[model samples]
Target: MKALIPTGDPAEPVVLADVPEPVPRANEALVKVEAFSVNRGETFKLEAPAPGDRPGKDIAGLVVQPAADGTGPAGIARVVGHPMAGGWAELAAVPADALAVLPDTVSALQGAALPLAGLTALRLLRTAGPVLGRRVLVTGASGGVGHFVTELAAAAGAEVTAVTRDAARGARLTELGAAAIVHDPADARGPYDIVLESTGGETLPVALARLARRGTLVWFGQASRTPATLDFFDFFDGPESAVIRHFHYLDADTGLGDDLAALVRLTAEGRLHPEIGRVADWADTATVLTDLRDRRIRGKAVLTLS
Candidate 1:
C-alpha cells in the first residue's frame, strides 16, 4: 500500500512511499482509507517522521478487517474515525474505540473532515459547560477546528462571536450562527463567558482578557507562530480571575467514539457542516501539506484515495 510519511525535515516534510498492509489487533480494525484531512499540528515538523511514521489522524473509509475479538464494528461498514497512526495510508489500523459508523447520507470526504477537528470543537465547548445564552467567542474562526467550534457554539444557543483575519471570508460564518464577525479580534466586545482560542501568541492575552469574570478560555492552537507572554497585571488586576484551560484531542478519554458518531450523525442530518477548503488525490500530498503549513487554505484540506 502507498502511504504518506514525513521526511523528518522542514524543507520537505512529507513524502509518499509504499508500505505494508497493517495487521489488526484484537481490539483494532484495519480500514481501507478512502479520504483523510491534514491538521495544522501535523505541519509543525515537531519531530522527524521516523521510517513508517504515517502522519495522519482523521480518516473516513471502509472496515476491511474487523477486530478479532469482536470489540470493533464489524468489517465492511463505512466509518469515520481517528487513527493514532497510519491514517495517511491506503489502509490504517485504528483502535475500535476510535471509530464510528457513518450514516448513509455522509460522504467519505465529509467524514474525513469530522474526526479530529469536529471532536476537538465538541470537547472544547463541552468544557465551557452549557453555552446556551452565554457569550461565546471563537478565534481563528475561519480555520478547520475553529469552523466547527463556531458552528457548534452557535447551534448550542450561545451568543456566538467569531474573530477572523478577513471579514470577507467569513460570510458563511454568519449562516453558521455567528452573531458578529469581526476582522480585528479587538473590535468584538469582550467579557465573554467562553472563549475558544485557536490563534495563540499575541492573540492569547487578548483572548484571555476578553473573558468574563471567572470565564473559561480554551487554548488549542498557535497559528501565529509567536510565543504568548503575559504581564503580571494581566493575570490579577481584573475584577475577578478568569480560568485558562488547555485542550488536546488525544486527552479526550471518555466517549471518544460516541462523540465521533454523533458528529457524523449531525452532519448526515444537515445540522453540522464540516468545511473542506480543498481536495486532492494522494499523489498531491506534498503540495497539500505545504499549502496547509503556509496557511494557504482557509478550511479543512482533504485528500482522496481514489
Candidate 2:
C-alpha cells in the first residue's frame, strides 16, 4: 500500500512509501480509500504520518472489515465523532463508527472534501441550535472554510454577508448565497448577528470590533498565516456592546459523527455543495502541498489515491 508519510520537515511533509495495510481491531472498518483531500492548514500542527504511520484527515471510501478497537458499529453516533486515519492511501483502516457513508449524489472527490470543512461549517451553523434568518458575516468568504460557512448560513435562512478580497470570485460568492459581497477587509457594516472569522493576524482585531452586541464570533481557522492579537476586553469591555466566542473546529468536539452525517445528508440531497479548487493525483501531492503552503490555491484541494 502507498501512503503519504510526513518527513519531520516543517516546510512541507513528503509523501512517499509502500507501507503495510492496517487491520481493524474492534469497532473499526477497513476502508478502500477512493479519494482524499489535504487541509493545508493542518501542516501547522501535525507533521505527517511517521514511517509506520498514515496521514489523512478528510476521506471517502468503502468499508471492507469491522472494528477491533472495542467500539460499536452501524450507528450515527460512532461514525461522525472520530474519523479514521490514512486517507492518502488506496486502502486504510478506520474505526467503523468513524465512517460517514458518502451519499450517491456526491462525487468521490467531493465526498473526500466533505469531512473536515463541511463538518466545521455544520458545527458553526447547525449544532446546538439554529441561526436561520439571522445576519451572518463570514470573513475570507472566498476560501474553502469561509465559502462553506457562507453556504450553510444562507441555507439556514440567514442573510449572509460574505467578506472577501478576491474580485474574480465575487460573482461565485453571490451564487453561493451571500446576500452581499464586500472587498473591504476592515470595513464592518455591523449589527452583525453571527460573525465567523476565518482570517486572523491584524484582521482578527478588526473583526473583533465588528460584532453586534451579544453577537457570536466563531474562529474556524487562521488562513492569514498570522496569529491573532487583540485586547479581549475591548468588545466585552463595553458590556452593552457585544460578546466574543473564539474557537477552533476541534475546540468543542462531539465525536465528529453527527456533524459529518449532517454534511453527507446535505450533499446527498444536493442541498450542500463543497467548493473543491484542485484535484491532484498521489504523485503530485508534493507540488500540491507546496502550493497550498504558499497560499497558491483558492478552495480546498483534493488528492486522489489510485
Checking candidate 1 for backbone clashes, the offending pairs are none
lDDT of 2 by residue, 1-306 (tens): 777777767565665788888766666677777777777766654555445545677877666555556454443222322354567777666765556766566677887887777777777664324677787878888777777878778877889888887766677878888888888656657667777887888876677677777777777677888898877676556324565665656655565655677777887787888888889887888778877777778778888776
lDDT of 2 at 110: 81
What TM-score against the true fold does each predicted structure earn? Answer: 0.95, 0.87
Tens-place lDDT per residue, model 1, 52-88, is 5668899999998998888768879999989887899
The stretch of ten residues in a row with the least summed lDDT in candidate 2 is 73-82
Model 1: residues with Cα > 4 Å off, grouped in runs: none
Clashes of 2: 17
* Cα deviation of 42, candidate 1, in Å: 0.6
